[model samples]
Target chain A: MLIKKGAEADIYLEPFRNVLHGAGQGKVMVKQRISKRYRIPEMDRQLRVSRTMLEAKLFSDAKRAGVPTPLVYEVDREDTRIVMEFIRGRQVKLILDSLNPGLRRKLCRLIGRYVARLHRAGIVHGDLTTSNMIFTDEGRIYFVDFGLGGYDSSIEARGVDLHLLRRALQSIHFRITDDAYRAVLSGYRREFGKGAGEVIKRAEEIGRRGRYIQKEARACR
Target chain B: MLCLGIEGTAHTFGIGIADSKGKILANVSRVYVPEQGGIHPREAARFHAVNARRVLDEALNVAGIELEDIDLVAFSQGPGLGPVLRTAATAARALAARLGIPIVGVNHCIAHIEIGRLTGRIHDPVTLYVSGGNTQIIAFDAGRYRIFGETLDIPVGNCLDVFAREAGLSHPGGPNVERLARRGRRYIQLPYAVKGMDMSFSGLMTEAVRRYRDGAHLPDVCFSLQETAFAALVEVTERALAHTEKKEVMLTGGVASNMRLRTMLELMADEHRVKFFVPPSEFCRDCGANIAWTGLLAYLHGVRQRLDDTEVRQRWRTDEVDVPWRGK
Candidate 1:
């Protein structure tokens, strides 16, 4: 297994071990080893093992919900990472930046519907952003990195996703987002049905309040 | 040869397809019909998803292309609704996968500017994007699009949408009020909130709604409201032109389709001897030709995304892109 390391863990890209060329099945990127700074050796080992299981479960749920997540081929609870399917796509946002509004909204609406499907399936992508998702050459959006994913039907979790998008739009594009953002909302409502409106409203309010609190905290600093 | 694109950033749901050369094949948008009040995000998202499928099919059918012939699938990536984003991403992914072709994710706002670039015929121009979800003046600088002026509070389109709701207009209140304002006898004076390059619309919206509640005709308020807000936008745009010294100004996004705003900016740009470019209405609103163009650019620049990069993020920053921009 070939390994790639990040701040949190070392991902072992299995299925490509000792291979000198590209694997026709695509790459299986596995996040396997995470270092624990706070726990004793035994406790750290157990924590890593459990988190590996948790991440694997999250990936399974994501796949089941048609989220185009990397399929978890295998997992070693002893390690923090699990081997999974490697997708062949670009970040959806990067693609968006290169296109025009018409296409941008179309893709965004599709993304909206996909996420809605996941939400309907009771999966909350705790960290939803343009960078975390991929758009495959096959036109499939495979959502990767389920480290923070969990099962939640709470409006707050969903709202937080929306809030993150709003902030992302404000911070990322900061241009030509008006109709584009609303289009995303329209897609959301279509997928979630009537309950989405109130939820979105409440989410917006919560987002506003959250920003206000953050601003105050920053001022205090 | 052609690709269908959809946009749902704010209240307006736009559908458009473009050819390989950045030509709009077909474009359509259904503005949100605001209820008793302003737009409800979730309601708007629902409307988009329902209308988007229909629009997508319409565009594909109109262009006489099957799912398989869609050489590449393109969709907006983010800076919008999570649910809505998911909807678009899912549709594109499914379509691409089903067709066994490539899928390209395009940024909603950048597409607007790219379309403007193609239509306006400017080498490098200053952009004033005013819509429901965003309000900013942008200029290309340091291999990235830099913001020169923006709304510190709510977006311009959101402000307009809210005010339009007060005026009994639909979700995308800009056009509704624009139509009604034509017949209104008087133009009331509203606050023009512009500070340096930064602007404010929340206070203006609150006041406009209040005046409407205080017995002002919705039409007059609408006309005056648009004029006030647009005037502020124009001032900042001119300032950007002055600061950047760019001779060409390109107007994109749904708001760019507004004739009054376009005319005002044109005249302002004219005063500075700067040419102003507003794309044809087809390019103004959300559409996919921009995506095709963007995809082409990314592919050309060797910025293809790896398969292991699969992660749906609610936040993606544009400056983070490592690709170097060499303007034409």
Candidate 2:
């Protein structure tokens, strides 16, 4: 069944036995990158195939780095699809604004821990939004959608990732973003150690640059 | 009552006259064309200051009103070149002080969206504002226009203009690039940088210029540039529309004049089952009418600026402004 349709892909849920060897009514997700008719055909195919492969690799690498990501089962680059373990959880985006303040802070911290781990592993979740995160029944956060991310340890890249997260919270969770994001930063510091400071500083810098804030400061009448 | 608005935010100096009845009496603009390169802020400001009298006279002449007949004065107050902003602000303040009328300092970006709403006669919309200085997907939320997505590095129009200048194209690069893109047959690969709701075009612009210098076909380069840039823009707009669940999609700014962008946005809006709107080409670019209209809305809602308080805000974000005129 087509469960979710994202910008560049459509996700389907299939019985575990259909893709894996054994079955106990478990379900696996089959994410297929859809070809965008708006793009040049050859370029479109190239982007989809490459992004599919890149996402799979990033997921695997992140999971190995002590972050909670859905386990990858199979990859089909030719068809631009990936069959992964299904995450049975609610999207944080839909529930974050309603959760109790304490629980929300805890969840935000957990999100930060996973993000710091990913950054430590030289990976950046390019599109780090609440929508891309799932809060499992196990009280853990699973980060998904590495389509826009890459293996970059540079502070600038990592900072840009954090900036994306900050911006997402501001726009989507405007009312409660300030306190939640502060907790997220605390969690990041708790996990990433001293390396977290420079990254966070850079993230602030990136945020100002993105808003053209510095330009105004310099060009003030 | 008549409102005279002056707009000198970038390369253009425009004057618009309007009334409380949502009728634009006159819209006149004189654009500054650079001799060899991009706009020089000082030069642009000088141009506005020098032609301020002439444009004001022309606007009043077009509106068929005398100077003392104007009751309100409005100007694009920020998010633009500092010197250019000051020139426009000074002009508006002078006119208002002499006429003993209230003056409004308008946000240039918000003016674009308001003008679209005024011209299209739509209530609320998920707006894609693409101009030389901005690329933002804006929607009204919480009594203000919130930016759902925007360009991270450089705006889409600037991306096109810089590439055009690099390739030795015309002064304003968007239309010229669009004209050449129609002749291209091949598609060259360009960096597609859509990261969540935000996009980056500096890398794409850099790469396109490099390819053209590397002996790539100009038409092919232009085609690929527009494809990557516009596709990224449209994707973000679609994402914002879906996220916000807005029933209408509007495109504005100078770049809105490009048919390719208009068509892409129209198709996306159709796919999303939302009403699509773009004002006539004249209203798309930077102008005084948008400022005049937005100013009127704010003034009617008790937004007033004294001479001492009419300071321009170069970094005034769209979300910072209170839209008392827009009901919750």
Which structure among the candidates has the greatest DockQ? Answer: 2
* Runs of candidate 2 exceeding 4 Å displacement: A17-24, A211-221
Q: Tens digit of lDDT per residue, candidate 1, span B1-328?
A: 6565656554567656677676666666676664656445567678877887777777777776665666666666755655556666667677766776666666666777777776766878889887666676877765677666667567777677667776676655777878876766666656665543556787889988998999988777777777778777876786677656778888877677688888888877766677888877767766666655665555555555432242333334333343343542
The alpha-carbon lDDT assigned to residue A40 of candidate 1 equals 27
Worst ten-residue run, lDDT, model 1 chain B?
B306-315
Candidate 2 shows a clash count of 0
Which 10 successive residues of model 2 chain A have the least lDDT summed? A212-221
Cα shift from native, residue A144, model 1 (Å): 52
RMSD of 1: 22.2
Q: Candidate 1: what lDDT?
A: 0.66
Model 2 residue A34 lDDT score: 82
Write down the C-alpha DockQ for each prediction.
0.01, 0.49
User: Which tens-of-lDDT digit does each residue in A1-221 have in candidate 2?
Assistant: 88976666788999988777775468999999987656668777888888889999999999999988888989998999999989999999999999999999999998889899999999988889999888889888888778788899999888988888998998889999899999999999999998899999999987778545534443443
Cα lDDT, model 2, residue B90 = 88
Off by over 4 Å in 1: A1-221, B1-6, B12-15, B26-36, B51-53, B169-172, B180-189, B216-220, B306-328
lDDT of 2 by residue, B243-309 (tens): 7888999999889888888888887787667899998888888999989998999999999777899
TM-score per prediction, in order, is 0.56, 0.95
For model 1, state the Cα shift of residue A197 in Å.
38
